[model samples]
Target chain A: MFQNDAFRALDRQESLRLLAKVPVGRVVYTRQALPAVLPINFSLDTDASVLLRTSPDSDLVRAIDGVVVAFEADEFDAATRSGWSVVVTGRATVVTDPDEHERLSQADPTSWMPLRDPVFVRIESEMVTGRGLRGTRGTQ
Target chain B: MFQNDAFRALDRQESLRLLAKVPVGRVVYTRQALPAVLPINFSLDTDASVLLRTSPDSDLVRAIDGVVVAFEADEFDAATRSGWSVVVTGRATVVTDPDEHERLSQADPTSWMPLRDPVFVRIESEMVTGRGLRGTRGTQ
Candidate 1:
């Protein structure tokens, strides 16, 4: 086999589910010649897409057109000794349709990030992956 | 002030320091209508700058041309009951000069990620921010 199980991963729905439960995640993309990572609040849509807002003349907008990118959302509670992370890899496109635009416009950013720009972009999942770790307390 | 103190918080150096420790982080930039996030493996330069590798044709190279962006890295240890996060916001430009490029080219990505590409981008922190949380051991 030409694949190592370490690199081989999961599908969209499973990754999306893990994403939905978490309130935060980092959006990864390339900036300049190096990889850039930024923290953001995101939402999981019915179509298995992740939505977030940005500015019109922003660098993020400049680099991310017609590209297969990765998106992730996750959460952890150290007290309970449990946590889960979900990553979504897909093609990101800036949505233009009005009804779709209105839907994002009407959504809340406070649930995600305090500072949200005027424009919104949605990433439709081509593939999604996730992993979870849970600890159980038991009597020895 | 009208702000959620919990979300609007950081320590400055922590974001930069955390980036050095955690190889994986999210990159945020604009992609048309929405803010995009992708996962990346990065290292912190001795001066506290963040660095990563990429291809010349990569989306990052195109988007981060002297633009303001954020490079964030973080970590959470449930077993240790502690966590911290770091972020850098600044302009990203390509390493057009040769000498600077060679220094970054030698960074070890194996412990980080399998990054292929010669181009390097530095998200110099115009403003560095950070935050941390630690769980307490109590009667559970």
Candidate 2:
């Protein structure tokens, strides 16, 4: 596969577009001075911010609030050895404004684990970058 | 799906088993003081160390060498909202020993990007943890 395909850097716009298409992604944050990643369901808002829903008292909510975090999503094919990945780095803020929270709540980010009293958090993207292998097709 | 199934933490042995099953996983490391995540092809050795092949000059090779890095892999089903994820945190070192390098090279970690001179790196596992949502099966 390396003989036939080449990796290309995706522009910022293209990266964000790909990010918006995926409902599941991994959020990387510092935990005990070590980087930790967790998969979460998310939605991309109109302004390009990444929104996620979790339990009010979950570790993700506590560890990520008001801290810089990285969000990543990708699609790859093992058979063809081709895929694309997008990464976003920014500060994650728990949604607190009543009106804005209500609006985002309507987006309904689904959680695989039972989320009683779901709390919404938004990561305002400060930098976005992505890379893709050309001439490949796969669900990301 | 969360309503029906509960998340269970997997033991270290089980986590390593899952990691070995997947051919591709994401490596997370600090780049310029910011956390960055990249998807790469990998193979797990008998000692539970993660091995990857990349260009000697690749940013991943440079940024991760001698650094504490996090490797993550998962399988999730969107419809059933079930999957498992394993994370290994360890220090990455470029394999320089000829004998060990030759043996690892035989493992055949395929790269999607053209690698004229592939460099092998090993992540010596310092910590391993995993979690799973019960009652689903998929390769991720």
Candidate models: Cα lDDT each:
0.60, 0.82
Q: Residues A48-110, candidate 2, lDDT per residue (tens digit)? A: 888888777777889999998999999887777677899999999999898998887676655
Which fraction of the native contacts appears in each prediction? 0.11, 0.37
Candidate No. with top TM-score: 2
| Lowest summed lDDT window (length 10), candidate 2 chain B | B131-140
Q: Candidate 1 regions off by >4 Å? A: A1-11, A17-71, A74-140, B1-10, B77-82, B107-117, B134-140
Report the C-alpha lDDT of model 2 over B1-140, residue by residue, as the tens digit: 34224778899999998888887899998888888898887888878888888878788888999988899999887878778999999999999998987888676655555666677889988899998877543221
Second chain TM-score for model 2: 0.88
Q: Least accurate stretch of 10 residues (summed lDDT) in model 1 chain B? A: B1-10
Model 2 misses residue A72 by how many Å? 0.2
Error of 1 at B104 (Å): 1.7
Docking class of 1: incorrect
Chain B TM-score in candidate 1, rounded to 2 decimals? 0.77
Candidate 2 local Cα displacement, residue B52, angstroms: 1.1
